[model samples]
Target: MNISVIGCGYVGTTTALMFCELGYQVVAVEKDSKKLAMLQQGKLPFHEPGIDSLLIKHLHRGSLVFTGDIEEGIAHSKIIYITVGTPSLPDGSSDLSFIEEVSRQIGAAQNDYKAVVIKSTVPLGTVDKVREWIGKAQKRPLPVDLVVNPEFLREGSALYDTMHPDRIVIGSDNPEAAETVKQLFHSMSCPIIVTDCNTAQLIKYTANAFLATKISFINEIGRVCDAYGANIEEVASGVGLDHRIGPHFLRAGIGWGGSCFPKDIAALINMGNNNGINLLIVQSAQQVNQDQIGYFIDRLEGELHGLNNKTVSIYGISFKPETDDIRESPALKVIAEVQRRGGTVAAYDPMVFDKHPELKLPGVRVARNMEDAWKGSDCFFLITEWDQFSKIDWGQVMQEMRTPLVLDGRNVLDARKLRSLGFRYYGIGRKTGIIHE
Candidate 1:
């Protein structure tokens, strides 16, 4: 199938490239001239592992075309996937202006029976509104079918997620249109769930909310385990071994942050508020997530008498490993808070420094290497669990630091090893009575 993927953002770019790899002719549309120029030159505006090679190869193969002309894209393709951004508004509702505008364009541009699939994350009843917008824009009754197909791609592992999704959800009132959309992913071995538009929308929001809840639930339990002298790792392992609650998002850390969880949860809460319902559990989960950094800071302060004039080293900056995305990263919040308390901060990340040079953290220095980050620092905070961080020489770090302190924000380090190396180790929800206020 010839597919046109609109808006070459994170989701759009990945989907377009994956479709091209699957032997489909793809037209990737981007409105920005600069982005189009970059893509045309085999360059991506963002960093995604393995996608760069595929993008260059497909662009060379002539299977993929990047352009700014929406009409050309709409005219060339039988299936149009609107993968545009629906960012959160100030009031926590999804701003559907982009999708609405694109829908009108698709309606005006289509001359034949076309299946318009929504691959963007939108609110409930959005497809109905899209249909209305498209109907009014069209000159006459053109055969256009609206399908809701939300994406479940993670930032770091987006390429893998795109090819091997856990499930393919197709939500459309038109069964024929839904089946037609299913054939797009026929190469992949996965379960396909066909339902109405609302169910599909809720499924995306609910899935993220539940994962957020799991993180917060484990973190809250970690807090209790901290008060007592219990190991959160052992407790979480025991709970996860039950087979009922498999260990996926059970790793307790600073909190959940990315392009998806925070915005989706807020929009869902706003959704509940508009309908005269209060989602208490989801609300509490959000609240607990918000408290994670501060909670960790309190523990850190308890470890050191205070953070005044202390030089702290941060191990990672990206929210999670393998991507340079620092959107809503706990490390940024921690850096700001630590600086507010009169501490100097330095950070080292494999991807963030060089790729994301525009990343501005007030009163923080981007370090060159692990040694440079640890050199003369009072303590180290392991914010993101990059694989390289686990392999650092703790003995060398202890010798280089002004104070041999290690605060495991993600708890990915070996606490026992750090302690044996004569370094003061403090992990979130780990019971080590080494620090007393």
Candidate 2:
């Protein structure tokens, strides 16, 4: 199976490598020469665990090819996966310029029958847009079949998520096109959902929005726990054990962040509006998530009296760990508020410093170590739950800070133990300190 994956970012690069590892001839198509050069030289532009080695293995075996030539990529493959980013715009709608441009390119290059898979997360009926773009670009009807196979990979664990997905969704109005796309994942040993294009796209939006709703639900429940003397962790754990509810994104902290959940929830609400529906549930999810972030900031303000003239240390920058993407990170939002109130902040993440050397947070200093971040810091905000941050010696962090205050935004830390160590600890949806007499 000859395959071409366009827009070699996290999704494209990982998917192309997965296809290559499955012994399919894969070509990663990118327009950025710098990115293409990095791929050609066995270096990935983004940090995804285990993807670099897999790309290197395929490149060494000559099963994977890297190029910036659109014609070469189109001519070499029968299955073209458009894995480009459709980032959310200011109006809460996705920026479809990239998707439209790629569709036109595929149409221009289509001389024979091809399965053009839309792997990017887009609004429903977007496959029709691709079909229309193809027809318009080629002047006559183009020999291209549209497939909706929206990707479900998380940023930090994208490679593993792609390799061992829960199920593969292949949607097309034409049965033949859907089956052809299903065959590409025959070796993956996962259930394939074969449906029409519109359902598939809606499934992506619905799934993401539902997950976001759960997160917001639990975070709001956390607020109740704060008011009452209930422990959210124990309550959530017991609720998750019911098997029907299940525990996935229910760890309730500063709400959902990263690229997917926020955008999808907003898009779903807008979609509901266009269809003349209120979508009260999805709208509450969006509003509650905004409150979820506020919950964290509120905790910080209680600790340091409105954040003015306080020096804080923010531990993680990325929305999640093991990826360099900073989109919709809770840390960024909280830090910006801290800066607004005459606060001085220093931040550090081992991964962000490695890839983006020029990454700067305005009104904040980038620190090199836990000590550096805590040297004169008044408080600490634990944002992304990176493994390194989890393994940090809290005793030392307590010793180094100007004030021994720590906020667990991810809810991964043991607040009681920190309090036992003579440090003031705070957790979202929890009481101000440990429940001690």
Candidate 3:
């Protein structure tokens, strides 16, 4: 089978490569010329582990190809996947202009039966809007089936998540169309859910909202633990052992941030508001996440006496490890807050700095290396927990810093070990008392 993926962003690129891995020829479409050139060369425009290698393999085998022309992509396959971005508008509603434009293009270029699959995360009832847009754009009457196949891939581990999804959801009013899409994933050993378009869209939003809630819930608990001198890790471990909780999204940290969670939660909240239903739990989750950043900064400020004239060494800039996606990243928020308090910022990331050498953060000193981030700094703040951070020489860090203050935002550092090195250590809900000194 041939598949056309429109848009070459992380989700689009990953989806195209996934189809190629499934033995289907894929033609990926991207309007951005730079991204198109990168894709043509088997180079990813963004940082994602394991995707680059798959892209190279597929291009070599003639299974995957890149194109900037939407008409060409639409004509290349009967199954057209709309994986374009539906970024959040200022009003918290999903801006579906991209989806709408793509739909119109597909419709305008359609000459035969086409199964249009929506792989992008969209608001509920968007499938209906897409159907309308596509119908109106067609030069004449043409058979087109719309399918809502929401993606559930994580950023850092996108390829693994795509190749090994927990479930496959095919949403369409037409059972035949749904079944046809379902057969495309017959080799994958996972439950395939066939449902209406609305339900599938809701499932995507609800899944991200619930995960955001879990993160906020645990972070709120972490605040309580901090006040009572309790161990949050132990608390989470005990709570997760109950099988009902299942130990995922239970890790408490600076809080959840990424492309999906914040936007989805906001859109879900906006959905509830438009329907006269106040989603209080989700609203609180959003609030708690925002406040968690302030709470961490407050601790840092109090420990330093004041941030004015202080230098803060930020260990990680990207939201999380193994990816360079900084959209809604908590680290950026932390950087902004630190600067607001008059602190000078020095930042380092294993991937972000190297991948985006031209990347500039206002008022941030980009460190050449991890050691450069902490040198002459007052506090070593670990925001994103890259694996390399876990193996850092804390003793050496203590010696190099003007003041040996360690704030482990992700709580991946050893509190005891840092304290033994004569550095003051603080982790969210972890023991702050000096263990060795």
Candidate 4:
């Protein structure tokens, strides 16, 4: 089968490559000329592990191609997946202008039956809007069916998630069209959930919202554990052993931040408010997540008495590891707080610092290397859970810092061992062990 994946963003590019890997010819469309040029050369515009290699491999095999022309892509395939970005508007609703424009273009170019599958995360009733837009643009009635097929790809491991998804969701009003969509995922070993468009949309939003709630729920519990000098990891492990509430999203730290959770939760809250219903739990989740950096900053201040001229180093910048994307990263919030308190902040990340120079906030120095960041710092905060950070020399870190205070924001450190090495250690939601001199 031939497939055209419109908008060569993270979701679009990965989906296009996955289609190519499935023995289908794929035409990847991108409006950005620079991104189109990069894709043509089998290079990714953004940082996603394992995708660029596949892109190059498929490009060599002639299974994948990149183009800037949407009409060409639409004409080449019967199944066109609109994987464009639906970025959040200021009002917390998704700005679907890109999707709308693509729909009109597809409508104008379609001469035969076309299945317009939506792989982008959109608000409820967006599939209807796409159908309406396409219907209005077409010269005559055409057999165009819209499918709501939201993506569940995590950033760092997007390709893996795409190739090895746990479940495949096919949403459409037309059973035949939905079944056709199901055929696209025939190679994957996962249960197919065939549902209406609205249910599928709700499933996407509800899934993210519930996951956000779990994060906030545990962080709130972490705060309680901290106050009582309890171990949150132990508490979370005990709770997760129930089998009913499996051990996922239970890791407590500086709270969740990424392209998906923050915006999705905000959009859901806005959706709730529009319908005259207040989503109190979701609202609290947002509040708790926002307050997390402040909580960490407060803990730092309490430990050091003041951050006024202290040299504080941060160990990670990306929201999570294996990707250079710093969008809505908690590390940024931490840097800003440290700067606000007049502390000099030095940051080092394996994948972020050089890839994204824009993260160089005022008063925050993006360090040249790990040693440069640690040198002469009073304290260090581990915000992102990168594997390199887990393997850092703690004894060397103690020697590098003047005060030897460590704040483990992601809880990816050995607290007792750090204290035994004469470094004061603080892990989120865990009891602070004493630093013996």
Candidate 5:
């Protein structure tokens, strides 16, 4: 299959590389000169585990070609996948201006019959809008059946999710186009759900909304545990053992922060509002998630009396571990709030600040190492549960910090052992010795 993938961010880049790996001749299109130049030199614009080698392999194999020409990209392939950004607006609605602009470009560039795939997450009936744009721009109707193919990828494990997806969904009014897409995915043996375009779009939003609800549900429970002096980790473990509620994303954390969950949840809220339907549970979950950051800060301040003129060291920055993505990262929000309260902040992450080179937080210093982050700090904040954090020698951290204060926002650290090591430990919704006001 010859394919053109527009937009080369995390989702588009990973999908382009995967299709090329599957032996498709891929023409990757990007408007960013720097990113296009990097791709031409076999360099990825961002950090994705194992993507560098995959890009290099496909470039050497002559299966992947990166470019910025809309005509060349359109003329070279029959299947065009539109993958762009849909940022959230101030009132939690999706700002799909980027996707709309790309639709205009794609409509103008269409020369023949092609499969236009919607790989970017958009509001419902967006595929119809793409078709409408094609009609408006081309004047003479372009022969393109818009397919709603939403991506359900975890940030850290995107490649794995692409290869081992729970299901492959293709939504279109044209049955032939739907089956053609199914046949194109010949390498993957995942369950295929062929449906109409609206259902496909809704499926993606509903999935993310449910997962976000699960996370907020647990975090809200953590709030209750904090008030009653109960341990959340233990309660979650016993509850999750019932085989009904799975253990994934069930742990109480600062909040759910990434590109997908926040945007999609808000989009669904907007959808309900437009149709005059009230979603109380989803709305409450959003509220609970918003509160998590403030709750974590309160815990830290309670432990140390006051954050004014205090030195705090933060361990991780990325929203989750194993990937360098900072979109809607909780660490950024928490650090910002702490500094707003007159505290000095320092942070060290295994990855980040590369693609986002201008990530400057006022009154914050990026640390060089674990020792440098912990040196003489009054308290330590664990925002993301990176694997290396659990393996650290708490004794060394306890020995180096100005005060042996540890706030485990992710609940990844052992509270008992840290307490025995002469460190005051705090976990979200856990009954630690240090109580928040």
Candidate 6:
């Protein structure tokens, strides 16, 4: 079987490679000349673990191909997966221009029936709009099946998640279209869900919204735990052990921020507003996440007497570890807030600074390494929990820093150990004072 994937981005590239691994020939289409060239040379435009090796292997074996021509991609396969981006507009609604343009292109180029699978995260009723767009672009009446196949892959472990998905959703008005798309993943052992386009789209949004709600709910509780001098880790462990609430997304930290959660949550809220329904829980979740940065800043401001002229070293830049994606990263928010308060900032990341040397954060100094980030700084703030961060020698950090103050934004550090090393350490909701041994 041959598969064509449009818009070679993070999702598109990963999706194309995934099909190749499943023993299907894949033609990946990219409009960007530079990215397309890089893909042809077996290099990824973005950083994802374990994908580079697979890409190289597939390219060497002639199982996968990259192209700049959309018509070539459209002609290669009966299955066309639209993995283009649907970025959030200022009004919190999705910008569907990319999807619209891609649909028209597919329509104009197709000579026969095509199973047009939309893998992008879009608003409800977009399937009907896509069908209308394709119909208008055609020279004459043609048969095309619109399928909504929302993706649920995480950024860092996208390849793993793609290969081992919890469930595969196929949304189509036509039963044959749904089954045809479903058969593409016949070898995978996950449950296949067949439903209407609207329901499938809602599943994607609802899943992200619920996960965001969980993170916000725990952070809100972490605030109360801080007020009473209680341990949030223990609370989360106890609550998560309830069997119904398995232990995921319950780790209380600064808040959830990434490409998907923030945009999807906002879009979901906008969808509610358009329907005259107020999603109070989701609204509160957004508010809580926004407020969390300020809460952490307030603690830092009080500890340093003021942020004015204070040198604070940020330990990570990406939203999470193992990926260089910084979209809506909490670390950026922290840097901006600290600078806004008249503080000096130095930052370090394992991958981001190296991958994007051209990335310019105004008035911020990028450090060469982790040790360079902490030198002569008044406070050390760890925003992203990269594995190397947890293995740092605190004794060296203690001697090098002008002031031995540590702020663990992700609550990943050993609070008791830091305090024992003559450093004043603070985590989100960890118990303060005497460590009993």
lDDT, each prediction: 0.89, 0.85, 0.92, 0.88, 0.86, 0.92
Candidate 5, residue 301: lDDT: 84
User: On residues 327-415, what C-alpha lDDT tens digit does candidate 4 reach at each position?
Assistant: 78999889888888878898888888667655547767778888889999989889998898878888898887888888999887988
* Candidate 2 per-residue lDDT over residues 1-437, each given as its tens digit: 89999999988999998888777999889999988999999999888899888988999999999989887898898889999888888778888899999888888877777889999999986888988987788745657889889889988888899999999998898899889889888898988999999899998998998888898899888888888868888889899998999977788788778888888887777777778999999999889888776777777777788778789899888888888888898888888877876788899887887788777776678888766887778887888888888788887787788888888888888777877887777776656534442
Using all chains and alpha carbons, the TM-scores for the candidates as numbered come to 0.95, 0.97, 0.98, 0.96, 0.96, 0.98
Report how far residue 274 has shifted in candidate 3, in Å: 0.7
The ten-residue window of minimal lDDT in model 4 covers: 428-437
> How large an RMSD does model 6 have?
1.3
Query: Model 2, which residues run further than 4 Å from truth?
Result: 431-437
Question: Per-residue lDDT of 286-386 in model 3, one digit per residue for the tens?
Answer: 99999999999999999999999999999888888999988889999999999999999999998887787677799999988999989999999999999
- Residue-level lDDT of model 6, residues 64-112, one tens digit each, is 9999999999999999999998988999999999999999998898788
* Model 1 bad stretches (over 4 Å): 139-141, 434-437
Best prediction by lDDT: 6
The lowest-lDDT stretch of 10 consecutive residues in candidate 1 is: 428-437
In candidate 4, which residue pairs get closer than 3 Å at backbone N, Cα or C atoms, i.e. clash?
A: none
Q: Which whole-number lDDT from 0 to 100 does residue 297 have in model 2?
A: 74
By TM-score, is 1 or 3 better? 3
Score candidate 1 by lDDT. Answer: 0.89
TM-score of 2: 0.97
Backbone clash pairs in model 2 (N, Cα, C under 3 Å; residues 3+ apart or in different chains), count: 0
Error of 4 at 311 (Å): 2.3
**Alpha-carbon RMSD of each model:** 2.0, 1.4, 1.1, 1.7, 2.0, 1.3
| Model 1 residue 155 CA deviation in Å | 1.6
